[model samples]
Target: MILKRLQSIGMVFLFLFGLLLFPIRSHADSAAYVIDETGVFTSDQLLELNDLAEQVTNDRECGVYVVITKNMHGYSERDFAEGLFFNYDLGYGLKDNPSGIILAIDYNDRFYDVYSYGAAGDTFTTARLDSLNDLVYDYLVKDDWFGACKAFINKCDELLESTGYVYHTIQYTDPTIAPHIVETSPEQRRNEFLLRLPFAALGSSIVGGISVMVMRGRNKRTGLAKNADQYIVNNGVRLTQSRDMFINRTRSVTRIQRDTGGGGHGGGGHSYHSSGGTHSSGGRHF
Candidate 1:
């Protein structure tokens, strides 16, 4: 009985030691900058965005990281964003206080937050971050994950470049648009043409049918008289009086309304302070 009791105690101690030694690991450092835990990005798109993030960080000397997960582990949007930025150890700035920005998106919760640290917070004002959200909100609503992420990166890069931190960096060209016209690839144009072909063919067929019906009606009416004029002897009747009659005429004018005031201005900018680091604004929810 004593031996059995000792063995049981020993097994309990061993189990407790195992539990202490093999605690669940946090996913904090599992990714570098962009983490798509929900598989929101395709292979090619993920590669492109990761490359973009790396390039931007190297060029600007500040981290522009993105984290896309299914949930935020019960933290609020802002807290999750700030926590991730710190836990991930993102930023290339000074050792004392790192500088960077992180865009955290929780797919399951349909929540997104943009958190900035150090110099990034100073550069990315509240209004500017809101504008960035504006660029991506519609795309996100439409489930265009890649488009939304690309927009976020593009806008961030542009804003960073504007601050003179990163100068003369080549911009990301949106394949969806050029100067005034939407850019269309050859395959896209072909697909469009193919999609409209049936409609065009139907329209042509309808017009052809109408023409044929009109021709048949005309054939049936050939040489037929609707009045007694055709039956009258050639040049048998003569008119003595000829006069012109005036009809009423009218015209219409459209009044054009002009905008009387210039564009309205916006309100004051705001920023959030987190753990002594000032972050930008905007938390989007679906």
Candidate 2:
């Protein structure tokens, strides 16, 4: 009886130990946003991008997916992209009205597509999606997978910000936020202001002193005209009956072109497949 009890206790301890050694898999592993089957990105690069993509998806409550496949699997780039999003259940939000965006690329065919669903479709405008593709193309052409992925992530972050989505975990400094002026911490700004205060004061003093001296010299050189008529020319000023005349009023109208989101001259647009999935896609031969 003693031996049997000891055995049971040891079995319970072993069971608890097994739980720690073999932890349950996270949803990230199952619903990975970055699927680089072509091995374009290194393991480290893939891990980094996956973390970024997952965070953006969660924050936006919308998906931002990327798939780098070896082939199109018998479907066009656009169709394949939409099918992948649908099949893999890649979106978030309501089941009937899921929201997400996907970027599918086939390195073998040099084809790529960017598509949005539900809320993401509304957030990522057609023009912005095409513009994003244009931005990523520069790196794709150079075979810089990591660079392209980074660009895509950064662009998505910016678009989300436009829709009032703020990312706090990682701070990415955008120079365009405040052009020419570099951002500084409070202490740095105060130190800089203090350092420049003396020079600013000196410059102001010099300018003020020069103006005062000039005004004093002018005062010394001239006396206020004792009489207004004394300084006036006899017929220097003449006023004729010149009524305010309006010669043909001219009006110029500028036609502010609206962005149709058909991608610019060489840009692309979104299309729908038979399944009713919308796709905003663009690509070129590398």
- Prediction-by-prediction clash tally: 0, 0
Clashing pairs in 2: none
lDDT of 2 by residue, 2-114 (tens): 99999998899678655433422232253378877677887788889989998988877777888877777566554667666665557766555467777777888877777
Model 1, 1-286: lDDT tens digits are 9999999988996786555434222322234667787887887888799888888887777788888877775566657777666655566666545677778788988988777766676567777767767777888899888888777887778778878763221212222212211233232345466566557757977998999999889878447557887678988888999899989889999999899876543334332343434445658896
Score residue 152 of candidate 1 by CA lDDT.
82
Report model 2's TM-score to 2 decimal places. Answer: 0.51
Using Cα atoms with residue i matched to residue i, what is each candidate's TM-score against the true structure? 0.51, 0.51
Error of 1 at 160 (Å): 1.1
C-alpha displacement of 175 in model 2, angstroms?
Answer: 46
Candidate 2's C-alpha lDDT? 0.67
- List candidate 2 segments past 4 Å from native: 1-31, 165-277
